[model samples]
Target: MDLSSSTVVENTNDFRATSIPTTINGLRFYHELDEWQQDNHFIRSGYVKGTNSYKSSFNSLFYIHNETGNIYSHLLPSLVIAGSLVYYLKFQLPLYESHLQVWEWINFLQFGFAATFCLAMSSIFHCIKSHSHSVARFGNQLDYFGIIILITCSLISIMVFAYHREPKFKYGFSCLFLVLGSICTFLTLDPKFSTSVYRPIRSTMFILFGLSGVVPIVSAVNTYGLEVTKRKAGLNWLIWEGVLYISGAVLYAMRVPERFSHVEQDQASLLNNPMVGKFDIWGHSHQIFHVLVVIAAFCHWKGLVQCYHTMHQDMLA
Candidate 1:
């Protein structure tokens, strides 16, 4: 049988309609998608219709589609982070004379790996989702797992640097984040949680996990004073990181720009109207969200570098 056939087959075991592959010539509109392909109604065009073959799906990477921006926004950043990690480890990593140095190096690696993993997984997920329904579902799980890992590791890196002197706080918070990350991983593994129906729930879970960083921030302020905490913990950068993350999340949830593209009465104004479906090939909320996520990760990376310098200075003193 041909893999590119669009014929929908019913599997009696799972009771789901599966579409075989088809040679998709051009982009599809929102209304043209099958149930499995339906997502983001606000994106009314530029969809790569399901091909149900890995070869076909991967080949789409070279073409323009709604997913192109989302894929490259994170994909390119992952490469940059990976390269930075190698450079930092090779030249800047101090020879460990103490446990603090070791932990600092470890925390730095954690942050680097998490950021790269998250971005790469997101790119892969978006790249191959059109292969089939099962592939799409699996990709969604990988994406969620990557996100949780990134959130957990980012917090762990921050806590490690902030409380480098306080062994009790440092180890305590590190363990706390590990446990929390594990819990989140477990929670997201539920198949229902991965569905679009639970998108807000998934977002809330991640937001809450990220917000848990505030606990250590408050503790830092109480123990070391606000100014010292700000200097040691990179508070300003963290705040900016938080703002960027929250902004991205809100934009993704609200589906802005595209959502407003077809609003009545405002359609006459070309700028305000968003050119009616122009965002489909680019500038959609998901694409914006991906860009903001990269920025937020960069801010965290800067904070980590600052924290490393602070640790070096304190060790010298």
Candidate 2:
């Protein structure tokens, strides 16, 4: 068999006129991928190839590959949170003597839905990323939309709970976040800003969007006093949520753990194993980010619960 002839045949796209490889393979290395498929150089191996078809993309979910961790990390959490949210609203809420107000229920449900939606979108993006470039781009846009929704709902819910007694502040913050979220959604979904080259810009935009929460928080503190705001609003849990989210975002942006893949570890060296290619299937920065996002969402949910209890008790009194 002439290898040069085979290479020319594959390049010609004449074998049934497919874009690239028509055969489903075991795994591919970094060098084997097309430009659009290439991501995370530190993950040197374990790629699923020949997934241009939607059938093939969905089938890959059952198979072990580099994205398995990423797909399930958010997928499972999304399922769990969604189920719990439904159960709480349907069964648990009835047990309370004082039912949540209509607005409160709306905010709570919106937050839960947004959190689960974000995770589910992330899972879908990772799962379909091995498909054609266009499909992957669409999935990426869906993921960004979910992030924007989650951020907007999270801030709005927090502000509403914090300013439960102040209608003006609550309504103002809600409007502000909705407008900002719309702007973010536009930027994120834009084809030009969706590329790797604009990653820093995207990250900065999200960071700044999140930081805007500080303004409302400080305003609440000034209006209600620090101790009252902290207790009533569950500020401590919100702080932990912010810390976890920021830490995860920083790690994801910097590409930690896997970024050290270039480091060598000799037998006599302090390290147990060489860092290269070790995190290809698991323990990568993206996986860490997914876990942190889930944990942060949990913290936010718990804080909302705190606020709910306080509000009910205060109303009863």
Candidate 3:
């Protein structure tokens, strides 16, 4: 064996060739969709569509980048919400009625699970999508399912608060959202439906899904009158939460900033610029969307708490 003359070559790109990093933890950069190939397929890069294998994605938690931010924004808060739920169960469960307690528990737990599950699915899907095309396809579908769960459960939480005032209006709106969510989940599970060719369709579907909440808002106004429900839910907070969500959704769908940005150009980038290239890894729409989504989740929590307090006082009276 000529150990002194032997050479070893790693199957990674030359680090000096570009600012993009070689395969290593905590320093991964994104690539364009066209850049994905056999040599670089396994590494966890961002700005590319689809998921990798579970083996590859399992290590994603330790990595830091736009993807990490997207995953952790939802992931970390889910943990906090979980801890809070544990406390609520231990300290506050006894305060509600023992008989109708079933409904209360359902309402309370569904909201937490919906929010947490949606986030967990998003992180997991983003992590494991690198597995293969089929895996990536399913991962996207699962993420869509999580979104549906979040929408369905959010409506349920509102129902819990206001259903008693107008049972007909509440149940009607609740069931409508549920059906819409289910259809969206079903449609998204199809691989073709999740593809880039269908990106605009997917985006529009979700935006419409969220906007459908407007119907219930009108129903709510008629049911409890404007003033009463406003006090319970904190109108300003809820409105701000919606503004955040709508803004984020619009950004995600439109593919802004990056769509018109350049890494080297410090100038104001124009629309549909061909420079929508590798520059998006730092401040892309998806990362921003997840951050806004988490904020909206917090807003939803505050509204729920305020509504619960108002209901609890009424119960006491």
Candidate 4:
């Protein structure tokens, strides 16, 4: 116990207990030597940080955090759908010998309608699904309306195609019927039914929208019997369209694998979230809806092509 040695030992002990600096909320914190850096791993490195700012909305395309992933998951396929329509117009439509002067215009309108419907549906789905009770309630209702609008637009596009091919038919009748159906559906979506209490009403409206296709489809098929290749192609198009539609409906209504594993899927990555991410993009219910829509559009295009071909052959005869 020499005095100088004792003094040196005390200083070394004090040094061992000195604190190290850390940061949180832009404020520096200090911890004793033993505790120093114990929580450092909890501090997120800037390199691995997730986007928290609304400014990185574009990041939704690549990142995996809540809304960003879901938003882009819906958007990418929409772009594909738009591109497919453009390809049809530029490359496919001109190949057909259509006489309708406004056929191109109608196709453009249909493309616009489909694109808008997709965007609206995506907005509604992402906006409401993760929100609070009030938000979920109101947002879900709006989402439902968006879905209805999408269905209506698709049905209208089908009728438009039919009208383009058979201008003799009264376009006004189809327009009036569509408008009336839309108004009726909107009115009948009683707020009471808006709750899960009457899911059947919501489902019925969807069915009505789908069933409306029967008018033009039957007219086209009956007028141009299966002897005509164009008629056969039209039938094939309708069949594929129906398949995509039914598959999508089943995936959506059942919620599939995600339904059984809600907790695991409630928060997911693009690699995960089978229902909303994987199946939802090109495979999801809405994507399937979009695919069916495109199939229907292509079917309409095929019918138009067949009509032009048949009419040209008839003139030659």
CA lDDT scores, all candidates in order = 0.79, 0.80, 0.66, 0.47
lDDT per residue for candidate 3 within 244-304, as digits (tens), equals 8888888877766555543322122322234433433456677788888888988887777
Higher lDDT: candidate 1 or 3?
1
Off by over 4 Å in 3: 1-17, 23-53, 92-100, 263-279
For all predicted structures, in order, the TM-scores are: 0.86, 0.87, 0.78, 0.55
Candidate 2 collision pairs: none
Q: lDDT (0-100) at residue 64 of candidate 1?
A: 72
Q: What tens-digit string does per-residue lDDT give for candidate 4 at 1-317? A: 69875664444334322321122211122122122112221111111122233333333334333243345545555666566666766777577645435754574556455555555566544534333344444545665665555555555554554444465553754675568566755664555555544444555556566666666666665776555533423446656655665555555445443333222211123124233222212233434444454455455445544544454456556
User: Which residue pairs in model 4 clash with each other?
Assistant: 279-283, 279-284, 280-284
Q: Rank the candidates by TM-score, best first.
A: 2, 1, 3, 4
Cα lDDT over the full model 3: 0.66
Instruction: Tally clashes: model 1.
Output: 1
Model 2 TM: 0.87
The residue-by-residue lDDT of candidate 1 on 145-248, one tens digit each, is 99989998998888777787898998898898889889999987787886767767777788888899999999999998999888899989999999999888
* Comparison by TM-score, 1 against 4, better one: 1
Off by over 4 Å in 4: 1-70, 90-92, 95-100, 127-142, 161-173, 184-200, 219-233, 260-317
For model 2, the superposed segments whose C-alpha errors exceed 4 Å read: 1-25, 263-273
